[model samples]
Target: MLRDEIITVFGGSGFVGRHVVRALAKAGYRVRVATRRPHLAQDLRVMGVVGQVQLVQANLRVPASVERALEGATGVVNLVGVLNESGRQTFSRLHALGAKTIAESAAAMGIRRMVQVSAIGASATSLSRYARSKAEGEASVLAALPEATILRPSIVFGTEDSFFNRFAAMARFVPALPLFGGGKSRFQPVFAGDVGKAVLAAFERDDARGQTYELGGPGVYTYEALMRLILEAIDRKRLLLPLPWAIGKVIATVSELVGALPLMPVIITRDQLIQLQSDNVVADDAKTLADLGIHGETVEAIVPSYLERYRHHGQFHEREA
Candidate 1:
């Protein structure tokens, strides 16, 4: 393969990054998966022929490391993001400054086609720090590379997604699943694969350059409806309790503390709760799945396939005697 045909994917070991890498590989593009720990992405080797996908260590906080990751690449895709800020990985540094560095590096290397994975609610004035950082990242990427295509997906879902898995696990322990803001918040839950394919498609199409696409699934669901669907998929009849925003924030604060432990926590954070206050769905006027010549997948069709494990008796539970 030509050197310029290689694509460097930052955060390729992450939930969305893995799918993007697989999609790029299938498109006959050599992939360089950049992450802090490259060993964790060894499984990606199966996505393509030997030597087609290479793994390398890259930390967004370090410009030299980021440059090394982007070295010898024709294009780049940034999938690094965080729901909560942590020590040395603040939203400003990782999403904003880090994004600027990557875009500049790619431009300096003569890589014009870049895809930046941002979130749906990205805005400079957004209340959620996550959203603000994402917006900043978009601005920085676009300014650095005017031809960059930025994709903002709304609450991407997949078999290994943290959202559905977290709720399914909760149904196993809690009698009721808490729904923030009366469960009225809506979401468009696009599949991770669809987004990945779209990224690769966009990378190949010059028409997509300088455009911002809002990717979402075919159907939209309220928070309560989503929870119910998850419960039904898991074969659990847990109550969907709606909590006020104030109370939810308090609970989330406590949960953040618990999450600091060596093990994962059972709950989320106040910032996450604040994020829930805003709906996560594609805008009507924005470019969508149909525009990319790809039809969106329904949650009903995909959720049950993986969520069956959370059912009372697993797959066998629904079998007729």
Candidate 2:
């Protein structure tokens, strides 16, 4: 049976967005993917049957475009966020302002069901601009639609994710990996698939409305431990060097400068370094994945499958006893 509800998902072409779109499609909701480039999001069409998924060009900075995206939509999902800022894509504009625009527009359209995906460390007083902007976005979404479900997930990991893939790529060439702040900061890496389920549950469950949930995995691991896990997954041994915060800051500054040059890859940003100063874990008192009836996947189960490509001989090589 086809459902009459339509869900306009902002940033539906992104990593996490793909998971959410897939879940929504499996659950029989028609998905309208609103993105800046409809041409680039053609892959999302395969997530649903022909005509079941539609793509429309929409820019959050333009209220008119945002308003148009919500036309005939019964629900909205704001998955748009930036890990790094570029020209015209600052944190304030994308995270806070864009979120507000979506919420307010949904409210005007009388669409009460909404979900906002935020980071776990989001706070008004956070030292990192990314976290602070996320907090602002959460506030704006709630203010405009008080019943909108806010999901704060820790570092999300998947096959195409930047976190594990980045280090695994680095291990391929670099002899050592730097552990910012002595690698003591902890993280509860949550799977991207589980987060998608959480979004679906939030929309279906009445208890989730107007509530904030912190999504994390079952186990917590330190920065160093995570790095070591990446190395082990790829069957490689590399030095895990402990770098002081001051030194990491200097390196990050230089990286930012070098990244400014055309064709240069950004290894790390100063703001990202600041984020590493704090633990990216769920709080003891926060509502968890279990509350939503999701059994989060472990890094050991999923990380190794994707990281296999980074191994010597690409998974054909046998481990020595």
Candidate 3:
């Protein structure tokens, strides 16, 4: 059945947003991708048939633009988030205030069906500003639309994910990878596509409303184990240097300072280091992907395929068993 409902997805041009948009298109819902630059997101139109997906200019910082984006929309999905702060894009502005704006805008437009994506380690009292902002955003969303579904996903992994892809790229040149805090912090990496499906489920299922779901993968692994998995995938060997938190903080501080320079990429920040101190796994009693009828994909099944590009010969070399 071709649904006539339209879903406005803020940040629909992003990595996770791409998956969500594709899922929405495949589900026969008209998708309006709201982004700051609609021209840059022209490729998203092909995800569906002619006129199934359209892009509109919308900046979360601008409340009027957000309201305009929700015009004639039955639901909204807030997938906009930033891992690093730059200029006016601080964690508080984008995560907390931006979310509140979207949620409030959706509510004013009589759009109740919504999904707010958050991180698993989000805590109001966390040392990391990112996590604390995420927690604040969750609160704002629920306060505005109590029936909106909130999804807190662990480190999400996919072809374009920064997590796995970052390390795999580093292994290509770096002699050794640093294990901050001995890499003991655990994570339950969830597949981006599965999270997309969960977004669709949130709209389709009645019980999903007003519920908070913790989306995670089938297995949990430590930071060290994850690094090992990346090295194994590329069939490469490298030293795993275990660094204490103090040393890691120092490195992060320098990285942040250097990152202040124009065009300089920040490898890590002190705030991100603080975030790594906490475990990013689903709570035992919390509702999960299974609760939404989604069977989370395993990292082994999906990661290796995309990681082939990082191989020495780019998938031509025979991988070790």
TM-score of 3: 0.98
**lDDT of the structure predicted as candidate 1:** 0.88
TM-scores for the candidates: 0.96, 0.98, 0.98
Measured with C-alpha atoms, the lDDT of residue 270 in candidate 3 is 93
Candidate 3 lDDT over residue span 182-288, tens digit each:
99999999999999999999999999999999999999999999999999899899999999999999999999999999998788899999989989999989999
Model 1 TM-score relative to the real fold: 0.96
Per-residue CA lDDT of model 1 for 1-321, tens digit only, reads 423388999988888988999899988899999999988789988888889999999988788998898888889999988767777878898889889999998898888889999989999999888889999999999998999999999888898998888899889989999988899999999999999988987887777989999999989999999999998788878888989999898999888888888777647887778789988999979987677777988899898789888887888887434
Best by lDDT: 3
Clashing pairs in 2: none
Best-first order by TM-score: 2, 3, 1
Kindly indicate the candidate among 1 and 2 with the higher TM-score.
2
Which portions of model 3 miss their true places by more than 4 Å?
Answer: 319-321
- When summed lDDT is taken over every stretch of 10 residues in candidate 3, the lowest stretch is 312-321
Which portions of model 1 show Cα errors greater than 4 Å? 1-4, 319-321
